[model samples]
Each structure stands twice: as C-alpha cells, then as structure tokens.
Target: MKRESSLKRATTETDVSLALNIDGSGIARISTGVGFFDHMLTLFTKHGKFDLNIEASGDKADNHHAIEDIGILLGKAFYEALGDKAGINRYAFQFTPMDEALCRTCVDISGRGYLVFDVPLTREFIGDFETELLEEFFVAFTANSKMTLHIASLYGTNNHHIVEGIFKSLGRTLKTACAIEAGNTEIPSTKGIIE
Candidate 1:
C-alpha cells in the first residue's frame, strides 16, 4: 500500500504543493526558490530514505510565506499517510556525527505535534537560509506530521556542521520510526492507539 497526500494552500500570499511517501527509496524533486533550503530538504529525503516532491511559489520578498506554507502542506501529507497509525514502529532515536558536529534526535509518531529544538548558531545565516529557519522547518514538520520531535546539537563549532548534523539525525530517526514492522498491526504505543 502506497500512502500519499497532495495539498494546495493559497491566499493572496503563496501557493505550495507537497507530496510524500512514507515507504520509498530516497528520491526528491524540490523547488522552493531558496537554494540552501532546497539542499537541506534534499538531504532530508536522501538520508531519511523517503521519496518526496515539492513545488512552491511565494512572495520572494518574504521567505516566511513560502517556508510556512511548505510546512503546512507537508504536515497534511504526513497526517494523511499515517491514517490511524497502525503497525508502525511509532518511536525512534538517533545520534549522528558530521565531522566535528554531533546531533541527537528522537521522535514519536503519536499524533501529537511537539518539538524541542536547541541549536545556537555562531552566525545568523548560512547562505541565504537563515539559521532560524531550521527551527521553522522542525516546527512545521512536527505540527504537520503530528509527531513529537526533539533535536539538539550536543557539540559543534561550525554553524553549517551543526545544522547539518541536526537534519541528518532527524532524517535517520524518521527513517527508523516509519519502518513497517512485520506481523505487527497494532500501534507501537502501549495505549492501543497513538492518539
């Protein structure tokens, strides 16, 4: 069974379309107009071993509209794909090291949207992507995916390395959490339901 979702959200503001697959080989076709953002997202897909495609257009004058809209679209897709959250691992954690940086990430696919992000960048921006946008990405992802996420950069000197560690860590964690467990059709939570 292949689960997928497509969403379009528009005001006078922006238009975004996002589609995702929970069980897929790593493949990505992304266009967000923000080059660095696209790169990070591509890494996200590749590392997470997910197939994802996104096309978004918004007021370039304000990156906020485009960024937030993508979040909304992705959230909707995750919620749709997990429908009832049966037979999933439901929880995962990872600690990844990228050269000098180390990041730890944990997630619970419990139909709850909560995020704990802790990474203080030595610089305000990396390329055109603001350092703070990392937070926005997780906030949006958790909210849309209806999952609890915790990300922390335990040690890193370079801002780029730090952020890269976080994304890679998250990707690996999600990859594990979403894996299908054979012969298990119940929510992994002890409560019988993830909600």
Candidate 2:
C-alpha cells in the first residue's frame, strides 16, 4: 500500500489543506500567500522525493499564522501516512550545501517529538518570511509529526543560502529515515513499536 494522507485545518486566522505521499517521484504543488515559503517547500519536496500538495489562505501577509499552520497540517499528514512505522529505517542524517552555506539535519522517527535548532541567519527576513519563524515552523512540525529533529548550520553568510540548505538537508534526511529496510518487517525500536 502506498503511504498517503490528506488533511485540512480551518481557524479564524487560517485555513490550510495538505496531501502527502511518502513514496513518490518528487512532485509538489504548493501555494500559501508566502512566496519564499512556497519556494522552500518546493525544494524540500523535490529533494525528499515526496509528493505533496498544499493550499492555504488567510491572514498570511501580516503575521506568522499561515506558515505555522501549514507546518502543523503537513506534520499531521506525515504522522497519519506513516501509520505504525513498521519496517522503516527510522533514523537518518544529511548535510547539504548551498553556495557558501552548509547545514546538517538529523531525524529520528522515535514517536518523541523534539527539535534542536542551532542555526545562525545573517538577516532578519528572507523575502518577507521572518528568519526566526524557521524555527517556529520546524517546532510545529516536529511536535506534530512525533519525531526528533536536529538542524545545525555549521557555517553560512547568506540567510537564503543557509535556510535553503536547512530545508534541503531535512528533506534528504527524512527521505532516508522513512525508507523501508530490506527483510526487516518490524518496527525500528526495541519495544516493538514506534508510538
């Protein structure tokens, strides 16, 4: 069975919907009023080889609600799609470089959601998307997806490059972590369950 999920959320601040496929050919169709965020999502989907589609609308221009909500919905989709996490590798890491920037991302689908973000951004905003919200996005994602994620930027001078590298590295790491192991049809934990 193909691992897939579709989810939606509506609030006074935003309304967002998402669809995800863990085993796919890197196809993405995303729109949220935030252009920079859309670009980042596209890169993540492409690198992860995950099929994702998102549509969001609301008070996205003046605040952080839209981006955060998208992260929440996406994370929920992932959790729903992965269901039981049997046979998954469950742990992976990757390092990606963009121009003069480099970032490392590590993930464990341990059913314990936590995030360790240690990145430095050279600017406050990258095309209207606040740089600090990058952490917020990942925080929401990690908590909802029930995974432990650690992202660190070893070095970076350009804010865009650093952020791009982070997303790309995260995508690659998740791709591996979610992969199925050959002849290992069991949950990755010693307890015989992931959650």
Candidate 3:
C-alpha cells in the first residue's frame, strides 16, 4: 500500500492544499508566497526524501496565518498517511549542522500531541518571513499530527542557518521515526495500540 495523503483546508485567513508521500524520492513542488518559507519546506522535503506538493495563499500582508495553516494541513496529511502507526520505528532523534548553526530534533509518533521548541534568535524577520512564525507552525503541526516533537537550536549566530538546521534535523528525525522496522508487524508501543 502507498503511504500517501492529500488534504485541503480553507479558512478566512488562508487556503492550503497539500500532499505527502512518505516512501518516495526527494521531490517537492511548493509555493506559499513567502519565498523563505518555501525554501525551508523544500529543504524539509528533500532531506526527508519525501515527495511533497503544497499550494497555499493567504493574507500576504501578514504571513503568520498562511505559515501556520500550511503546517496544520501538512500535519494532517502525515497523520492520515501514517494510518495505524504499526511496524514503525516510532521514535527518532537527530542533530543537524548548517555552517555555524546546529539544531537537534527529536520526534515520537505517539498518539498524543506536544511540542517543545527552543530557538532563540535576535532577528525578527528573514526576508518576507517572520522568524517568530516558526514556532507557530510547529505548534500547529504537533497539535494536528498528534506527535511529540522537540526542536532546539543548540547554537547559532545566523538566523537563516539556525532555521535551516532545525528544518533539516526535523526532516531526518521524522523520516527515521516513520520508517517501518523490518519484520515488525506490531505497533511500537507497549500498550499494544499506539492510539
């Protein structure tokens, strides 16, 4: 069976359509109006080796709505694609470095939703994207995806590099966490059922 999902969400603030294929070559076609955000999502798809397609539009004067909504839709797609979460690794952690920046990400594909983000930046904006919106995106994603996710920028001087490291680490961690373990036909939980 193909582990894939597609979702569409429209609200007063934004409109988003997204698709995800968990087992796929790294291929992305994304357009969210915010160029920097698009770059980050592209990197996320590429590093995770996940096929992703997203088209989003919103109040461009304020990017927060669009960014957060995209995360929600993407997370919903992941949740749908994962299905029963059986035979999966379920937990993964990774540390990624980009130039002078380093980020660590840990993911648990639990049925509960939670997020711990620790990214400290001195700047407020990265081009057209607001730096603070990153946390909002992750919060929405975690809430919708029902995953426990932790992301921390251990050290970084440049905002761009820090964000990039976070995204890359997130991608790698999610990729490992979602992988099916060989010959494992049961959920990776002690309670017999993950959900």
Candidate 4:
C-alpha cells in the first residue's frame, strides 16, 4: 500500500494544492509566492526523502493566509496518507545542526493535536518572509494532522540557520515516525489503536 495523498484547499484568501508521498526518493516541486518558504519546504522534502508537490497562490499583499493555508493542506495530506497508522513506528526525534544553529524536533503520530515550538529568533524577518509566520505554519500543520510536535532551537544566532535546522530536523523526524517497522503489524499504541 502506497502512503500517498493529494489535497487542495480554496478560500477567499488563498488557493492551494499539495501532494505528498511518504515513501519516495527526495524530490520536490514547490511554487509558493513566498520565496523563503519555498526554500524551506524544498529542504524539508529533500531531507525527509519524501516526494512533495505544492502549488499555492494567495493575496501577496500579506503572506500570512497563503503560508497558513499551505500548512493546513500539507497536514491534511499527511493525515490522509497515514490511514490507520498501522505497522508504523509512530514516534521519532532528531537533532540537526547547521553552522551556529542547532535544533531538536520530535513527532508523535498520536490522535491529538499539539505543538510546542521554542525558538529564540532575534530577527523579525528573513528577506521577504516574516520569521513569526514559521510558528503559524507549524501550528496549522499540527492542528490538521493531529500530530504532537515539539521543535526547539537549542542555540542559534543566525535566524536563517536556526529555522533551517528546525525544518531539516522536522523532516528527518517525520520520516522516522512514518516508517513501517519490520514485524510490527499492529498499531504502535498499547491500546491497540492510534488516534
């Protein structure tokens, strides 16, 4: 069974489409109006070894709607792709470093939605992208995917490196969490069900 999903969301503020394949070589084709966001997503797909395609358009006067909606659609895709969450690891964590930045990320495919983001980014913006919107993206994703996600930037000075590390770590952690473990044919919860 292929773990894949395609999703679309259309609202007055934004229109977005996304496709995800959990099991694939790292490949990405993303075109969002936000350049920095597109870069981050590209790195995420490459690090996670996942195939992803995203096409998004929104009111460029303010990128908030577009960024959040993309996160929502991406999360929905993951949730749909996972199905019953059977025969999977269900939990994963990773610590990634880039230059002067280090970030740790943890993911749980629990039927609950939660996010704990702790990043001390001193800068307000990275080029055209507002740094604060990164949290919004993760929050939207966690809510829609019903995932327990924790991301912490242990130490960083450069805002770019810090955020990059976070995304990379998240990608690696997600890959591990979604992997199908050998000889584990049951849901990874003691209660015989996940979510």
Each candidate: RMSD to true structure? 1.3, 1.0, 0.8, 0.8
Name the lDDT value of residue 112 in candidate 3. 88
lDDT score at residue 140, model 1, on the 0-100 scale: 88
In angstroms, give how far residue 143 of model 1 lies from its true place.
1.7
Judged by whole-model lDDT over C-alpha atoms, candidate 4 comes out at 0.93
Candidate 3 segments exceeding 4 Å error: none
At residue 100, what lDDT does model 2 achieve?
96
Question: What tens-digit string does per-residue lDDT give for candidate 2 at 1-195?
Answer: 789999999999999999999998899999988899999999999999999999998683564898889989888888989999989999999989999999999999999999999997778889978888899999999999999999999998988999999989988999999999888789888898887
Which pairs of residues have clashing backbones in candidate 4?
Answer: none
The TM-score that candidate 4 achieves is 0.98
Model with the higher lDDT, candidate 2 or 4: 4
Q: RMSD of candidate 3 to the true fold? A: 0.8
lDDT tens readout by residue for model 1, 1-195: 776676778767888888898777889999998888888788888999888899988885757778877877887788888777788788999999989999999999988899998887878778888777778877887898889999999998988888877877877898888887898888777777775
lDDT, candidate 3, 6-98, per-residue tens = 999999889999999999898999999999999999999999999999999997569989999998998889998999988999999999999
Query: Which is the winner by lDDT between candidate 1 and candidate 4?
Result: 4
Error of model 3, residue 79, in angstroms: 0.7
TM-score of each: 0.95, 0.97, 0.98, 0.98
lDDT of 4 by residue, 1-195 (tens): 899999889999999999999997989999998899999999999999999999999985788999999989988889999998999999999999999999999999998989999998888889778999999999999999999999999998999999999889999999999999987789988888876
Local distance difference test, candidate 2: 0.91
TM-score of 2: 0.97
Clash counts for all predictions: 1, 0, 0, 0
